[model samples]
Target: MLADPMVLILMYFVLPVWLIAGFADWLCHRATHIESTTGAKESLIHLLMFVEVGIPLLAAMFLEVNALVIAVMIVAFFVHEATAMWDVRYATTARTVGPIEQHIHSFLEMIPLMGLVSVVSLHWGQFLALFGTGTERARFDLAWKQEQLPVTYVAIVMLVIALFELLPYVEEFFRGLRANAGRLVPAKARRREAGDTAIR
Candidate 1:
């Protein structure tokens, strides 16, 4: 329940940007899954991505903007945009990745980042403790530094790695990806031996 003009402005400001960014990510992700490596110019993915990255920074341009919120939003989009850029780079290389792999990768990256962003937004309620959302006083401040800073910083940094380093570190990830996959296969030889003994 937010009623103040500032909250209203932030809502108006954030919703449209979220819609645009989410749509862009959806389209780009779809293209990666369908075409997997060949849909660029025809795709509005890049245009949408730019909008996404720009929105939070745009919000920050005002002198009254909340640094903590703006920082979270900016870092969130930074991670997202960086991921998009890496996808483009990897597709250009056209190495071992395919549609399923591309699809799997994009979605996997998004899940946790979204959760961290959620925490940043929700904690606004906790710090204010006013049973509502949006007000002039809701502007992010250092009043709660002992509580907010470290958690937000760590979350932002983790998302940044996923976005920026994900592609370059593909080889390192693959070893884990394959290892987890192998764990799923079960010990086939043991099963086979059991079956043979039963047959006898």
Candidate 2:
């Protein structure tokens, strides 16, 4: 399957989409952090990204190309689109996205569909084959014989994006924890410690 031209084409096409979208998301997240927003919309957008990339990657690696898989992709696509629209609405209404940022957001929103199309085109034959007689049942078997490289590459890309989205939150969480720890400690205890140090 890796030898197939369609597969090769999709493999190449998906990389830029992954990079561009991931970068846009990272930029938006950085802005959100800098502005110190509530992060509700940012959180949802990242969650949607995880779902959009994660499910398809897993399905391509582990599951057979079949009607059920296509159905799942369709559902996931719609859900992602819905969340994406909501994200845009929230950002625009909240004035979180500025003029320059809107261009990045537009590109981020548009390119995912091309990625989806690439996946579907690569599996188009299998999808058509399912419509033939006696092939309607779901296939849960692993696609070890299929082209695993694209799936692996996509998985790595998603992992990178996941890290980009998560690292800031992780840092913020630890910082908050440390600050709260300080706040929880008694002021009298801190002052006593400080006094003991001064005396020493």
Candidate 3:
């Protein structure tokens, strides 16, 4: 198990911890946005990123764990979170949306997706054991044991990017049909969003 250092770091150090940071951040990020439905509240997603960011790295450092493992997770989680924030910034409104509009509202919909992704990974212990951490190094040699399970991979992959990528394509396709599911934004709302609508 403690054979290849890279696998060791990946399986134990980075994979699990990164999951923690990214998933937790994702959840908190979604909750904030869903609760308010306006303003930069959703932008606070980065805050969750920070909390779990250093935890794995720091723990790895003190416990003689793998720094490389920590580094990889930090990077992956950051990319995922950063893109999400931009998606939210681009979509800043709380218009009433039907199923189609709701689908097109990528950032808003991610709230629940994020919750599922982040919350599902709260089982840190299982992640560690699966990575091969029970004997010696508890968190520095795990290598995506989950990947071995194709079905699990499917679920994991879907949970990760389903909302961001898949949902958009579906929405756009249906949108072209003027399906009864979507909405043409009111001219006034569009104007307001465009900074043309006058204030009361």
Candidate 4:
């Protein structure tokens, strides 16, 4: 399998894609505050993209290779790409994305396309073979093939991006909690403290 040219192509492109996606995500977070603009909605969309892409890619590494898996991956990939394109348009038109941010967005958009191309190239034969088989050929099973190290590495990078995307909402949750706590404090105690301060 390592001898396959498509496998080699995927191995080569995976790292660059992970690095570019991470950096572009950081740039986006830096360019806009989550609560102030469309950042929250955009981030949520990104989270979906991560789930769709990362999960299938990871599964493909360990699962039995089959036509059904390839079909699922193809569908997932297209959905991921669509969300990514929507993210770019949403970021650019719905909010004020800076020149640097726009550049980052454009580059980020290409990473998935390249990845899809590589994956499709790698599995093209299998996909075509599926069509030739009868309906009874459809089966999902784990082949327990040795894990692809690159898939794991990419998943880790995406996890970091997930954390970064989540941080803003986490902060907002705590801020709201604190605000509610303050409101619940005893008003009489606050007035007593104020009187003590005046007496000093």
Number of the predicted model whose TM-score against the real structure is largest: 2
111-196, model 1: which lDDT tens digit per residue?
A: 33453354346445433433344443455553323222245544653464345433323432233235335332222222432212
Rank by TM-score (best first): 2, 4, 1, 3
Best by lDDT: 4
Residue pairs of candidate 3 with colliding backbone atoms:
8-140, 8-141, 10-142, 11-142, 11-143, 12-141, 12-142
Better of 2 and 3 by lDDT: 2
lDDT string for model 2 (61-131, tens) is: 45656656766676777777787776555444322455666677676666656656766676665566556
- Residue 89 local lDDT, model 3: 44
Per-residue lDDT over 67-130 for candidate 3, one digit per residue giving the tens place of the 0 to 100 score: 3444344454555557555544433444222344334344433432343233224434434554
By summed lDDT, the worst window of 10 consecutive residues in model 2 runs over: 191-200
The stretch of ten residues in a row with the least summed lDDT in candidate 1 is 191-200
RMSD of each: 16.7, 11.3, 12.9, 11.7
Steric clash pairs (candidate 2): none
Per residue, candidate 4 scores C-alpha lDDT tens digits across 52-106 of: 7666666655565667777777788778778877766554433455677667666
Q: TM-scores of all models?
A: 0.31, 0.64, 0.28, 0.62
Off by over 4 Å in 1: 1-70, 124-133, 136-200
> Candidate 3, overall lDDT?
0.39
lDDT at position 62, candidate 4:
59
State the displacement of the C-alpha of residue 159, model 1, in Å, after optimal TM-score superposition: 16
